[model samples]
Target chain A: MVERTEKRHTEKMKKKQAAHDKIMAGKTAEKGLLIVHTGKGKGKTTAALGMVVRAIGHGKKVGVVQFVKGAMATGEKAVFDAFPGNIEFKPMGEGFTWDTQDRARDIAVARGAWDEVKRMIEDPSYDMVLADELNIVLRYDYLPLEEVLPVLTGRAPMKHVIVTGRNAPEALVAEADLVTEMTLVKHPFREQGVKAQPGIEY
Target chain B: MVERTEKRHTEKMKKKQAAHDKIMAGKTAEKGLLIVHTGKGKGKTTAALGMVVRAIGHGKKVGVVQFVKGAMATGEKAVFDAFPGNIEFKPMGEGFTWDTQDRARDIAVARGAWDEVKRMIEDPSYDMVLADELNIVLRYDYLPLEEVLPVLTGRAPMKHVIVTGRNAPEALVAEADLVTEMTLVKHPFREQGVKAQPGIEY
Candidate 1:
């Protein structure tokens, strides 16, 4: 019985290895990518920050532009600020939609943030650029797709870009190399009556 | 026309502020939580690491146990290693399931990792504990639910715990204070024929 079980496991392992090797063999080409994190769940921006940390660990510089969360300083921002030479953080948003009810002003601020992104993209010093909540503005049509899409797709050949928010534009999704939708399965605020905490949420 | 727009914006801001204040009034309770990141997306573990970075920034000690990723040194591990006194990382997995075909051995290793987790939970020194990929082992029944759920629910009242992986158990989900399901809208490996890159995917 033991011998039969061992033989079956060996055969299974060999088959799985062959499949993985075949798929990995065709995946050798490398280039900078456009990644999107969207949907009605948490962790979109948090995941982008994770990439920033990874890039910094590799001795690469990172740039972050917060499009709609500039009113308050967050825990993540504090940590990012600590890495002075490695991280460049520009919090440009005035506030949330309800707090800033002027659509025209929101559009103007979005343009300003995009200008910063364009500058960072052209600078070879920044290995990765994170456009935090750029999707929210894009979804609200605060920025023109004709302008945003071209600059993103035409970025330096080896500079990675990450755009994060809830509702990414269809054009951006089509042009992205990777897109993840964070589905809202369960939320503490809704079910367990828990509010966001300092270190974990921010 | 500009004056009218300004007046409308001011009134809207007032209403929004009132609503925010009312919500904030009821959110006075603060406590530790169990946050679960699950589903078929790419950011489960990455999101948890973001919190780790935040906790370390606040001078909070953290304990991380990688359940199924012990074979190699990752970029994140290097970053965690940099914070010698603040972060403790243990990569306890032998490898992925296919790499290790022995179910009995996998169970034993998982038990060993859980022993470390219990110790971390009871110890007051660590502010947060991240059980990376614990859900995968639980999904495979390597660790029984009855044995796992109690420790998770009975942890230190002030110590935060995060469990990340795909296919979280129903019992675990029910017990968790926050749960996020990362849905795979698009993947570079499947859609763009791109392989995982060094600083991004690792």
Candidate 2:
């Protein structure tokens, strides 16, 4: 019985490998990607930061601009600070929209953050740029989508850009090369009364 | 007109802040979390690695075991190796299930990996334990869910554990404190003929 099962598994794997190889053979293009992480769940920024870490590991330069989470200190900020040569970490926002309470001020902050993002994209020295929470700013119309879309679309071919937030615009999703929406299944903050702790939330 | 807008914004923000403070005040519980990142999209393992970086930044010890992605050298392995004191990174898998093509071997490898995970969970010096892609093994019945769920649920109260993969068992999800499902919205590999690159996909 075991020998029969082994034979069946080997035959199935042989067929699967052939299929996988054929698909992979056609995937020959290598270039920078526009990755979007969206949805009402968490890990949008966390995943983007993971990419930043990967870029750093590969000895590539990275630029990070936090659009709506710069009001207070965060664990990522402290971690990114350690790699001064590899990353230019900028948390330019005053706070979340509701926390800031001023539309005009929010727009101004977004504009400033967007400028930093543009600088990183246009500069060839940086290999990856993370526009953290840019979607939230776009959702609130703090930064004009018209202005944002063109710059992102026209970025250097070899440069990677990651935009992350909840409620990403339809146009951005359509243009992205890879997009993942994080869906919240169960949250302890709501169901178990657990507070956000360091090294996990931040 | 601008002054009126500013005044209204201030009033709205005041009410929002009061509500936020009240909600935050009630959240006083502090303990370890069983975080599960599962779905068909990308970033499940990436986000878990991000938390590993965060833990390293905070001077906390971390244990990471990659169940099914150790056949080749990955960029993350090279990076995590730099932090010898903070992280114990282990990639125990021979490869993906189809690539291995032997159910008995897969089960044996999974058992070995699970032993490492359990060791980390039982070790008090480790602040966080990441069972990277553990759900895939559970999904395939390579590791018994009955044996897995209890150890995860009965872990030390102060030790955070993160399990990530697609198709998480419902029991694990139910026991988890935080669960995020990564849904594939658009993939470049399917749509744009792009292959996964080192810094982004690894």
Candidate 3:
């Protein structure tokens, strides 16, 4: 029985190896990417920041422009702050939509954040730019899709951009090279009846 | 009109504050959680490590047990290695199942890794324990859920445990306080014909 299992496993391995090698052989082109993290679940921003951290680890310059979550201090911001030279972070949003009901102000702030994004993407030094929560701003129509889409497509060829938030637009989704939607399976707010906590939520 | 907009904004802020305060009033209980990152998309492991980086930023001890990815060096494992005292990491797996074509050896390694998990959870020194890719082992039945669930349920109240992998069982999902399913919308492998890249996929 052991011999049979070993033989079967070896056959399976040979098949998988061939497929992996063939697929990888066709994958030679390398360039920058526009990655999107969106959906009705947690870890959208967290995953983007994870990429940022990875980029920083690889000695790549990273710039983060937080579009709609600047009201309170977060642990991520604090951690990024520690890596001063490696990270350039700007948390420019006023707060959530309900917290700031002024449409004009939200638009102005989002534009300011976008300007920063433009600067970061254009700068040759920055390899990765994270537009944190830019999806929410776009969803609320604070920034016109025509304007934002053009800027994204015009980014540097070697610069990776990560846009994160819920309800990402279909146009942006179509434009992105990689996209991951975080699905809500279970949440403390809905399941355990708990609010967001530090280190976990922030 | 400007004055009217300002007044409307003030009223909105007042209503939002009241709602925020009301929701926060019931959120006095603070403790750790069992967070599961699973699904068909990417970022399951990245999100879990993002939490680990956040915990390290907050000066907490972290223990990471990598179940099935120990062959090649990853950017995350490299970054975590920089912080010696803060992170205790064990990349216990030989590799993925296909890479290691020995089922008996895979089960043995998984069991050895689970022993490390048992030690970490009971040590009381680790504030957060990340069982990275534990789901894959459980999915293959290398380790039974009956044995694993009890150890998880019996963990310290203040300790946070994050389990990440694909095909997480329904029982573990039920036991978790937070679960995020990363859904694949667009992948480089599928769309752009690219295999995993350094500092991004790793």
Per-model C-alpha RMSD: 2.3, 1.7, 2.3
- Greater lDDT among 2 and 3 belongs to 2
Best by DockQ: 2
* iRMS, model 3 (angstroms): 2.5
Q: What is the TM-score of chain A in candidate 3?
A: 0.95
Angstrom error at residue B133, model 1: 0.6
Clashing pairs in 1: none
- Per-candidate TM-scores read 0.92, 0.96, 0.93
Of candidates 3 and 2, the better by TM-score? 2
Q: What are the per-residue Cα lDDT tens digits for candidate 2 across B69-122? A: 774246566566666798888889988888888888989999999999999999
Off-target runs (Cα >4 Å) in candidate 2 are A71-74, B1-8, B71-74
Show pairs that collide, candidate 3: none
Better of 2 and 3 by DockQ: 2
lDDT agreement with native, every candidate: 0.84, 0.89, 0.85
Put down candidate 1 lDDT per residue, A39-147, tens digits, no spaces.
9998998888888888877767999999987743466655666567888988889887667777778889999998999899889999999999999888777888888
Question: Over the full model, what C-alpha lDDT does candidate 2 score relative to the true structure?
Answer: 0.89
Q: For residues A81-182, write the lDDT of model 3, one tens digit per residue.
A: 656788888888877767776778888999999999989988999888999999988987778999889888898887789999999999999999999999
- Sort the candidates on lDDT, descending order: 2, 3, 1
